[model samples]
Target: MDLDALVGRARSLAGGGATRTVLGLAGPPGAGKSTLAQTLTAALGDAAAYVPLDGFHLSNAQLDRLGLRSRKGSEPSFDVRGYEALLRRLVGEPAREAYVPDFDRSLDEPVAARHLVPAGARLLVTEGNYLACDLPGWREARGLMAEVWYVDAAADLRDARLMRRHTGFGRDEAAARAWIDGNDRPNAELVERSRDRCDLVVTSLAG
Candidate 1:
């Protein structure tokens, strides 16, 4: 996948006048965004932290309260207001370190006060489904990033991966298939429209 290329580019951004700006990676679910983010953060060392958009997802109770559980991955299901505030804070470059939550998929919960970015960090690699979007306040997201990347993969392959993920999470095979075909695909289509907003198109080879 030539992660070194991305690692080197991000490392250089910290050296120059760049204020450890955010790099947004936008892609559909099961698109390997977390994999890429984790890999890049490790490759970049202390200069960067992987800030996830998934942490902004509303809790299950919140979704149930809003009647948005069936549309969980949709844009309307997240705490966009909170996410915007966090982005504002990061862009403000506060002198003190701030704590951000990380989404723990195995537990299907957001781990509180887990990931922290030091004020002097040189770069932040944020990955999520909505960063490159143009819906409502979502458009404001692009303005907060120094750069963006979009990942594209074969649809069949994506579905295969997603179905396996759902089944691994204990869903029955029929339910897993339905999720991949219905909700996931619709969200993927919507997310793909934002690819035009990216600075780079990353087409990864399977490892």
Candidate 2:
């Protein structure tokens, strides 16, 4: 679907007495969830705000302590409960502004309160891999969203994009490939299994 169509549907969910209408974009790694979230937020102007669940990525230190640093992007490496609480605040307290953390890919860490959702924003866009997962916190997160869209792409294309991202963020070519093959691909498979749970399935998003 076109950007306008997506915006229209999101807008429709925000009218009348609604407090905050959340449009969830769920997908496997490299499926363009971040791209769609940014595009929709920009297209919707001040009416929309973005809160990525990636912002809740556990710190590298915490990951090391948990012995999960090698599998950083996996679901267990995130602060799922924290992300869920932030979602609740977005929909529950419409009259108050919410400060949201942002994930810095360059630093591979989460920066606190880097983005804010103003009280006037009618729509909130949240994107992540686990939004539609049937796992504990994810199922509750899915229930919190007004609508969920599953972003998808061909496997080869997705793998290529992920490799580029990993290298750009600092890994060497071989390390990036190993991480993608061993860690990311498994997480992608887990995410894809929940595709049918989303309200819509979007194969490709425009540049």
Ten-residue segment with the worst summed lDDT in candidate 2?
A: 10-19
Q: Write the per-residue lDDT of candidate 1 for residues 1-207, one digit (tens) a residue.
A: 367887786676553444557888888887878788888888887778878888888888888999988887788887777887787787676455888887777877667778998766667888888888888777787788888888667787777788888999889999988877778888998999999988887764463
Misplaced by over 4 Å in model 2 are none
CA lDDT, every model vs. true structure: 0.79, 0.90
Question: 133-175, model 2: which lDDT tens digit per residue?
Answer: 9999998888888999999998888988998899999999999
Give the best candidate by TM-score. Answer: 2
- With candidate 2 superimposed using the best TM-score fit, by how many Å does residue 155's alpha carbon deviate from the native? 1.1
> What's the residue-level lDDT of 59 in candidate 1?
86
